[model samples]
Target: MRVLIVDDSKAIFMMVSQMLEEKGHVGIWAEDGVKAVEYLQENSDVDVILLDWNMPNMNGPEFLEKNLTDSFTKTPIIMMTTENKPDYIKKALSLGAVEYIMKPFTNDILFNKFELVDEIA
Candidate 1:
């Protein structure tokens, strides 16, 4: 699987990419939503997106609002954020995120979440 990782933190991206690599999935990262959008424009074959709520230039929700249309409507977007607020989670789901992953997560937690997305997809 090819996963798009959108986060501002280099550590987060590295951690997630390493985990995905261990799972035999390829990970492509973008520092923020703007770069993510640009990457998506060139690589629409990505299997899923791991999105961060807070980012510079373009946030997760704004990214969803801008790109979740036409061919991208049903693409799976999983929110990987430090924001634990129920309202925020609800808002992200309402905006088309398939699931939410809180920060400080373990590889097992991330793998389990990925399994869920795979099942649905």
Candidate 2:
């Protein structure tokens, strides 16, 4: 799968990209929501989005709200963040996030989440 990873942290991008590669998926990254939007505009083959909740310039929820329309609305977004509050998860889901994964995740956890998402998609 071609996955778009949107996060501000360079380390997060590196780690996630490595994990995705290990699982035989191509992972493209964006430092913030603005760049992510640019990438989306240029590429229409993204299968999933691994989004970080907190970022400079534009946050994950803001990005989803702004971009998840028309064709992009059907794209799956799995939020990767430190926010674990029920309300925060609720808000993300309400705003169109398909799944949520807490930060500092392991390879197995991420892989499992991706597998679960496959069923839903």
Best by lDDT: 2
Could you give candidate 2's per-residue lDDT for residues 11-31 as a string of tens digits? 999999998898788989899
- Model 1 spans with C-alpha error above 4 angstroms: 69-73
Error of 2 at 45 (Å): 1.7
TM-score of each: 0.91, 0.93
Scored by lDDT, model 1 comes in at 0.87
Best by TM-score: 2
lDDT of 1 by residue, 1-121 (tens): 8888999999998988998899798988899988988887777778889999999999999988887563443568999888899999999988888899999899999889988998987
Instruction: Pull out the clashing pairs in model 1.
Output: none
Clashing residue pairs in all predictions, respectively, total 0, 0
Query: Where is model 1 poorest over a 10-residue stretch in terms of lDDT?
Result: 66-75
The true-versus-predicted C-alpha distance at residue 88 of model 2, in Å, is: 0.7
